[model samples]
Target: MNSIIHILQTQGNDILNSIGQHITISLVSLLIAAVIAIPLAIVLMKHKKIAEVILQITSVLQTIPSLALLGILIPIVGIGTVPSVIALVLYAVMPIFQNTYSGLTTIDSNLEEAAEAFGLSRSKKLVKIEIPLAMPMIISGLRIAMVMIIGTATLAALIGAGGLGTYILLGIETNNNALLIIGAVFSAILALIFSALIKGISKLSLKKIGIIFMAVIVLMGGYFGYKTVEKPQVSITIAGKMGSEPEILINMYKDLIENDHPNMKVSIKPNFGGTSFLYKALKSNSIDIYPEFTGTVLESLVKTNKDASHDPKATYNLAKKLLKEQENLDYLKPMKYENGYALVVKKSFAKKYNLKTVSDLIKVENKIHAGFDPDFYQLKDGYPGISKAYNLEFASTKTMESSIRYKAIANNKVNLVDGYTTDPQIEEYDLVALKDNKEFFPPYQGAPLVSEKLITEYPELKATLNKLAGKISVEDMQKMNYQVAVKHEKASKVAHDYLVSHNLLREK
Candidate 1:
């Protein structure tokens, strides 16, 4: 508990920023849903058949999985707040409209007759009598929708939309309970705050609620308008895949580049999404650069035969060539360390099984219960190729996230799991990496991959980037990862300390 408090105190700035983003996303999503669903509900109130059809359509939208919806939106609209807001709006519309429709339909006929008898116009009657009568139900619907929006907005982090979910996901990845607790607690608090606010709004007159909403809108607009006129700077966006290593590497990239070029502003979108997400973001100019492994580049970004050579030099050269020829991406000079995949197990288990190599796994294949990440379960250079190369198949397999697999193995829930050579948890959990004698997986030397547009615009960035060439060995990476993941240190601090100590960056 003391450790968690310490972490919270140290990460106060980051948590506050995440809270601001979380509030903005939640409120914006609910506001948009209100604009669409409330008016639609009003129109549908007089038409029973149309109301049923529209409600059914919205229900279908609600049923679409959040991830599936995000997946569909990414290629079309790209990542970040736009897609996140759109998906949340879709989920919110159903609840908002359904509750609103119920409220409008339940308004007493006597009240409408009284307003009609008072010579009130249709719009006037709606404002005077019908609205007052229906206000409770309408506010009820908004409260439900607002609470839903706040909770669901956490998913936005996966698409580079900043929120508390960033911590939540990172916590899961690093097996850090403090981070997980902070994210979950803050998210719940946001939902509760909105719910309380809506309850208070329900008690106030309609005019007061309208005033409050307009005030919020005006403040947000003014803030953005003011920001729009600020002094301009050359901004470059750098993104990375999930995990501490990528976050640390991007932090180094940011520090090195910004320290050298004071006029430049570096925006980091760490843990933006998966490999495909980052690649697409780069292609779309959403991100300028991200650290990618040579193995992933060869396997995912480009096509190759099943038996592509796993040699470090051969793979790096081929990846560099193919990326340039195919995607116009420039791969920086490779770092010294290789963060390649291996079949990992407890030291005791490996000793018991005499599992010294991937070939050795074949002998006890039926005894192995392995957990792997989604990509490893399906990718050619992963399970499929490993199975073919060694003629091995596990007795049972569970597909899970990269981070969860480590804890799963450590807890003795699964006997075998996939691991990157530089994962801090491998050392923390006392696990051993089984030798890949068959060379089924490619060498994953890290390098910064930049879009052509970025380099063309800022050609000097190449020099700053290449400064990391042949730097950061496996042991060095593991130590940095441990500091950030286990010690709960900020990635930026860890990265900065490493850079200064190694003379990679002068203290400025």
Candidate 2:
């Protein structure tokens, strides 16, 4: 409890920012869903068969995993608010539509007939009788949708929409329970608040409802208007993958760029999914720069399996040249540390099995289970790399999220898990990384991967970001990751302090 309080006190600004984004996303999505579902339900009241068919279809659509849906939408609508809202609306529609249709159709037939006998026209009967009687049911549906939206809105942070989920994912990555609790507790509270608001709106008269609805629209419009009023001269958005290190590195990028160009604004979207998502965002010009690994470029992005050098300098040079030639990207000078993937095992497991390298894993391949992330399970530099190089395959393999794999190994749930060379958990959990004696995995030196347009617009960015080139040795990165993930220090503070300590930033 004290730890949570301390985190809240120190990180109050970031917490508030996340809350604001979460509220806007949930409320806006719920409003849009209601607009679409309520009217369609009203129209479908006459066609019960059509309504039933539509509801069933929506039910089936809801079963599509939100992450997969987002992945599908990223290339089409791009990431952030649009895709997040669309996914939430698809999930929200079924309940609201179902309840609204039931409310309208289930109306006491006697009242509807009496209105018809009293010479009320069809439209008038719907306006005067059906809508008023059905208001409570409609409100009830909205309440249900609102709760679900609030819960799912956390996923928005995965694609840079900014919500409490950012804290949740960061917590999971760094093993910080305080951060996880904060996100979950706040999300629950938001659900309750929205539910209460929907209930209150249900009790209002038509006049009161109109007035309240107008006030809400005016408030939302004014807020959005104010948001657009002040546009920065040069706005730069930096994105990162899901990890403490990416978060820390992007913070450093922001601090460095902003310090040099006070006239410009830099936005850091940390933990914006993995390599594919980040690359797509960059390609769409949705983001300006992100940290990319040389090895990832060869194996994942460009997929140039031929002539992919394993030597650090050679890989960096080849990647830089190829990226510029084909992708129109700027690969900045590489950092010193190599965050390559490696198979890790618990100290006890390594000792008991006498496992010390990739080849040794062959002995226990059929005996031990392996846990790895989806990217590592499928990517060439990951599972397939060793399988082809060492002629090894695990008897059973389970794919989990990046951080969960680390936790799984520590808990003895899995004997071996794919891990990054610089992950602090390797040290925290007393795990040993098997040597890649065959050199199947290439060196993954980190560097700023910038868009060509951004570089053309502000050429000075190259010099600013390149200050860390050949800096941040493997030990330096490991220590920073440990500080943020293990010690629960703020990544921004960690990055800033590292810069100041190393004289990379001018102390304010």
Candidate 3:
């Protein structure tokens, strides 16, 4: 309870910002869904067979997992508010469409016959009689949709849409229960308020409804007008992976760059699913720059086998040249840390099996269970690379979220797990990093990949960001990660502290 209150106190402004963003997304989605669904529903009333097929299709879309839908849309629409609104609009369609169809179809046949007897035209009868009578049911459907949209809008934060869900996802990522509760509770309140507002609107006279809608339009116009007036000179979006180190670096970069150029407004789009998602988002221009590793891009993305070995400079040069010629992306300066993937095992399990390296895992083949993120299983530099190099196989493999793998190993649910060398969880869970005797993995030096177009526009940004080159060592990054992933500190605070300590930022 105290923690919740503290979060509300410290983050009051952020909470309000999220509320406004949530209202905007939900309202816009509901409006779009209504525009399409109502007309489509009317058309369907004329074609029963087609209506059935369309209804089934909408039902299937609703059944597709929300996260899965976001994933599909991210590749096509990239990320941020556009994809989120599109997904929410699809979700909002079913209820409104069904209700409109039901209401129009259930109107009394006798009334229609009476109107026909009175010489009323088809369009006039629909406009004057059918729609007015069905308004109550349609309004009720809108109420239901409003509530569902409000709830689902919270998930938009996962793709960096910036709503109440931002707090929730941040809380989960940082292990802050108070922040999570604040987001969940506020979203519920918004839903309740909107539901009540819809109910009230349904009870209002036609004139009053018109007045309220006009007021909403005015408010929307004013909001947009304010945004246009205050638009920044330069708006830059920097994105990164889901882990602590990437999170910190992105925040640090945002702070330093924005501070250096007061006219520039820097924003972050975190949790871009993974490497593949980030890469696609960059190519599609959904994001400008993101933190990536040279070896990951070289071996996994570029599919290079020229044997750069453990040399960071060689790996970075090759990555830079290939990305420039192939993808039109520039690889920035490399950091001091090498955070490649490591096959980890509980110390006790390693002791029992006499396992010291990837080679030893092969000796115990078919005896141990392996747990890994689905991405790790699919990527070439993941299980495939390790398995082929060491000729190792596990008894059973389970794919799950990367965040939970640490706990799964700690609790003895899985014997071997794929982990990053810089992850604090290995130390927290008392796990051992198995040696890669074959050196199948190459150097993974962290760096930013920027769009060439962005550099052409803001050439100064390259130097501002590169000031961080070779600044953060493995120990510094590991500590920062431990502070966030272990101590539950805010990523921004950790990043800020690091920048200040390094004298990278002018202290305010």
Q: Count the backbone clashes (under 3 Å) in each candidate.
A: 0, 0, 0
List lDDT for all candidates, in order.
Answer: 0.87, 0.88, 0.83
Per-residue lDDT for 133 in model 1?
Answer: 80
Sort by TM-score, best first.
Answer: 1, 2, 3
* Residue pairs with backbone overlap in model 2: none
- What TM-score would candidate 2 get against the native? 0.86
What's the CA RMSD for each of the models?
3.0, 3.7, 4.3
lDDT digits (tens) for residues 35-147 of candidate 3: 78988988788788998888888888899888878878887987878899999999989989888888888999999899999999988888778887888878888998899
The parts of candidate 2 lying over 4 Å away from their true place are: 1-5, 47-64, 75-78, 121-123, 231-234, 343-405, 408-417, 430-438
TM-score of each: 0.90, 0.86, 0.81
Residue lDDT tens for model 2, 130-160: 9889998888899999999999888898889
- Show the lowest summed lDDT stretch of 10 residues, model 1: 225-234
The runs of at least 3 residues in candidate 1 whose Cα sits more than 4 Å from the true structure, single-residue gaps closed, are 47-53, 72-78, 231-234, 347-380, 383-402, 412-416
Report the number of the highest-TM-score candidate: 1
What TM-score would you give candidate 1 relative to the actual structure?
0.90
lDDT of 3: 0.83
